[model samples]
Target: MSSDASSPLAEPAPAAGGGGRLVLGCTPIGNPGDASPRLLAALAGADVVAAEDTRRLHRLCAALGVTPAGRVTSYHEHNEDTRTADLVAAVQAGHTVLLVTDAGMPSVSDPGYRLVRACGEAGLAVTALPGPSAVLTALALSGLPSDRFAFEGFAPRKPGERARAFAGLADERRTLVFFESPHRTAATLQAMAEGFGAERPAAVCRELTKTYEEVVRAPLGELAAWAAEREVRGEVCLVVAGAPAATGGDADPAALVREVLLRVEDGERLKDAAAAVAQRSGVAKRELYDLAVRRRAE
Candidate 1:
């Protein structure tokens, strides 16, 4: 079968219609070769193809040499709210609707969640054709432990919001994964170094499966410095090592006090800082605060 999207090719016979189904098709993240045969078949046979970016979807179809027979429609963040109902309606009319994003699986930091929810609430049959995924790929490539991990889609754009976001995950014991733009990668790493500890190990995976792919593994502090010195580009994935296992014994009161003071210097209220450090370190806030006061006197 010639896989040229523009080339004329015989279409497969449509499946016997009972009721319409919603199919979530995963696309290649970088390399087109990662696209699966099942994905191609689904794309070619769907009654309506809803894509995050119609242009990118066309490019993918051209690259794969398989043109979709269904009407292609835009279904992105800007119009997802309105387009979702129409897509669901198509499925309700006994037409197979395929949902795809520019890359990876739909609804993974991508559009399609609303439509998926609608399909489920309507009791429509939904299925998926899985393929390339940047999250799993980066986690596997990252030297960090991946036995257990969490994916935080993107850090907040503003510095304070981003810092607070990191602060909430400061004590996450399992490995952490995040998607960051090239421009914000450095700043995010810096915030992470402060919130999670400067010496916390992390890996920055860039342009996975592409020609210029790079995976840099280092402590959060070092990565922050490296990012500061150069222009980092491409799709970036950050895999950070989790917090160190807490000792059963109480944390040193002096160390906890110093941490609280540092947070205070960073503009956090002293009491709130003490509470935060106490909760994270398993030390009593009142004891730590009294120790800090006495130390200040000396």
Candidate 2:
């Protein structure tokens, strides 16, 4: 669930056309018991199955006692674009095209995005069989503030880009959830510790809902060191705590106000300048920005 005001991806126009043939079925993120009747029905009735991993699809169907009568086509990140048209066409022609990802919802961080976008654009009926999602699951287990959070699917592979990415999110007051590969988990955790601070509390959830699952709760620095020393296998979810609360009572409000105003005089946006002062002085943005303006006038 992206909170972007104009989320082009989250919502779909399911009534446009296509004779209600295109189906987006969500498999369980973890527990097989999470599987829904809709998912089983879709598996049994689809005319064509576009799966991120065909083998996993086979196993999933086997677990649910569903023998798919549809042609299973590979529709993963590597081949989603090329195959979207064919899948959509089949649905538009009144064939039930079921889209399943390796796990979880299709479009959040998977191959179903292209096909869904294509269906939305084509005025085709794009219904969903919602079941489970790792993003919401981890957020629930994190025990962090969940009123607002952002899901950054995966961080950049390169270090510099990753640094800038974390810097941009430094002032975010809401909890942040992200997925990372086990192979690069150490690198990612190290960078997070560096960018978000080694002391920030975080939870490393691994192989969520699967057997042999592990959840490590600790400060970012400890986790970073722990991650580097060993091999981490399975899906990884990093739930990092939000920025620390302000320590406004320890500082001279008047003096801090003067300095913040000077920086705003240098042409920074009010919101951004306010955020900067908040991070540096541990002052509330609302109070600092208001004082900055008052000091500027006086």
Candidate 3:
């Protein structure tokens, strides 16, 4: 493939009467080979290329053997607010504006949402060139339930916020996915163990698609210990098994009472804890609340 800016893959100019459109290009998370052909064409042909990092965009282009013919500008968190209007204006002027982030799709825990929303509100056409995603990759590699899951993005950085977030999801039945910095992986895993339960099955996926890609599968407690024992490196994704299905009327009353007490010990109000546990176990919330109160007294 020619690295020339005028490569044949570049699309021809839009028709005279056609209004311009906003194209979201999904970049490779790790390996450059993951770049889609559509992404390459968009980079070469778009009139304005808005990138999270122009240098990284050039690096990707270099690796893909292509040169962007368009004008490239930085469009990241810091500049997103200021740049949205200009980018939208470019599109309105009948110029194709391509948005690319450092990795993965733009607007996913990255810059681009504001621009997209602005464009949408202006009645401009918006489209995406979907490609690599760490969320799907990690979930598939997790060997856990993929049929249904929730993407929690990144866990809260503050200790109290993180605890409350995890506690709120304790009874979530769908599998959960999370992203965390390499430095905080151990600490986050420890918190997950504390909030989700020590024996909850989970996977720690890091450096996905790169040379050192590693996915550690084990109980949350074990993963926490593993992270603590070594220096974790690279971007990390966490996939955790959700709460087990409620056993309905067959559930052990004693076990349910114990579960309620655990939540109370974690600082949840007795009534709130009982209601949450009751909903998960298919028990009457009022009965569960009374039983928990009596158990506390005992």
**Which candidate has the highest TM-score of all?**
1
Give the TM-score (vs. native) of candidate 2: 0.76
Report the lDDT tens digits of candidate 1 across residue range 162-241: 77677668768999999999999999999988778788999999999899999999999999999999999999999999
RMSD of each: 5.4, 8.9, 5.7
Stretches > 4 Å off in candidate 1 = 1-15, 248-280, 288-298
Worst 10 residues of 3 by lDDT: 1-10
Error of 1 at 46 (Å): 0.6
- Residue-level lDDT tens digits of model 3 in 194-213: 88888999999999999999
Question: For model 1, what is the alpha-carbon lDDT of residue 210?
Answer: 90
Q: Highest lDDT: give the candidate number.
A: 3
Model 3 residue 84 lDDT?
81
Models 1 onward score TM values of 0.86, 0.76, 0.83
Q: After superposition, how far is residue 103 of candidate 3 from its true place, in Å?
A: 0.7
**Ten residues in a row with the worst lDDT in model 2?**
1-10
Candidate achieving higher lDDT, 1 or 3: 3
Distance from true location, Cα of 132 in model 2, Å? 1.7
